[model samples]
Target: MHEPIVEFQNVSFSYGSRVALQHVNAVINKGDYIGLIGPNGAGKTTLIRVLLGLLKPSSGNVRLYGKNIKEFKDWHKIGYVQQKATTFDATFPVTVEEVVAMGRFAFAGVGRPLDHHDRHRIGDVLKMVGLDKVADRRVGELSGGQQQKVFIARALASDPDLLILDEPTTGVDVRSQHEFYHFLHDLNVHHRLTLVLISHDTDVVSTHVSRLLCINKTIMDHGCSIEFLLPSHKHNDVKKNEQIFKRVRHKH
Candidate 1:
């Protein structure tokens, strides 16, 4: 079941003349829970954009599910929940179920009414996220944590195999954040979802994820989260590893 899902080969990206990422190489396998951590302006978001096919790399290749991202068309199989759900307009008039139903548009097609299967999927995802009670409630009325869950449900409505979240806990409370990570853990272990989480909270990420991919404009380190948290002396390149860990820990 550990099949390759995402592959980055000698990938490099730039913004104008400023280099964002350089010669990055990594493989994310199916059922892997990976925490992607880095400092501010560390090219973490750039790498994600490249993987999502939003930005073309200056050099090298990105493959999603063994297909070159350029040719990959099964976008619904990959779900993405972007940062800052609380920042969404509170006045938007859509209901929670409506919002989640939007995720199925790719399969349902634009200007087309949702079929029974699509409606059932929307309900299943909402129930999966524990938001079935609020299905008919307006989305803007929900709390920040609930709003985050709604987005997660929206992403899940597509029935994606791989889920990617960018700073998902930004506006959530501490208690909610704790519960949120537990929910993510359940998705990874029980549902067999492949998760790629990008977060600034190193301690939280390290505790929850199976593997850690540390980066700062390059592939700084890649290994099990336990290995990453080990004492400096245990590493082959102790100085570089410690520095990268420190930079990630303190900066953000």
Candidate 2:
């Protein structure tokens, strides 16, 4: 079997005395588009934080690209588009191009001048997100959907092997959501970029993702999308019991 791009082995995490995750073991292979789905407070965000190295597990191990998470030096290898309302600054005067160029901050020295290569990279990313015409427009001036695309463009500027998105379609119109999903499909299929998406729209996500991880406190299920969508045998048993109860009531 091919080695996984990201691995979590017997991982556990806690906040104060409450356990957020418990003995979670998962492996994500290269070029896999995975959907992480669960209700609120089910530790979806916690898992993402752990993967991003922002939070450490209390026990067990997390490896990225065959190295310990702590030792992984290539941060730019993963692109992240956080929940729409989390990081966008409506009052900021930065233009769309400037926001997209922010992805290069890690490569460019702080307070140092940008070179020709940096400008070209920024331009390329802007065009990729279809924001070239609005490159000079202030981010606040654009619609919510446009702003979301800009954030996506910013992440793509780094040309990451994997893209992790947290609720990328939140608060957008139905049409906008459809467009974003098509863009993601293109990125994954045409460009071979892996995607890990955390979303509440289970039906929509199931259509695009190759696999599904149903997380609630821990991993409830991880497998092909079809298996994830099918009602489990346990659920079928419950339905059978309900039917028996209805028959008994009608006969009485």
Largest lDDT belongs to which candidate? 1
lDDT tens digits, residue span 1-252, model 1: 679999999999999999999999988999999888776687888899899899999999999999999789988889998867667687889999988998988666799999999998998898888999999999888888899999999899888999999989998899999999999999999999999999776667777787778877777643434343444436477776666556445432
Separate clash counts for every candidate: 0, 0
Please write out the lDDT profile of model 2 over residues 1-252, one tens digit for every residue: 665889988888999998988888888888888888766677878888898899999998999999999899887989998876435567889999888888776556478777889889989878877899999998988877888889888888877888999998887788988888888888889888889999766557766777777776788643423233333424566664454334323322
**TM of each candidate vs. truth:** 0.87, 0.85
Off by over 4 Å in 1: 222-252
In terms of lDDT, the poorest run of 10 residues in model 2 is: 224-233
Q: Which pairs, if any, clash in model 2?
A: none
For candidate 2, the lDDT comes to: 0.79
Which residues of candidate 2, in runs, are more than 4 Å off?
86-91, 221-252
* Strongest candidate by TM-score: 1
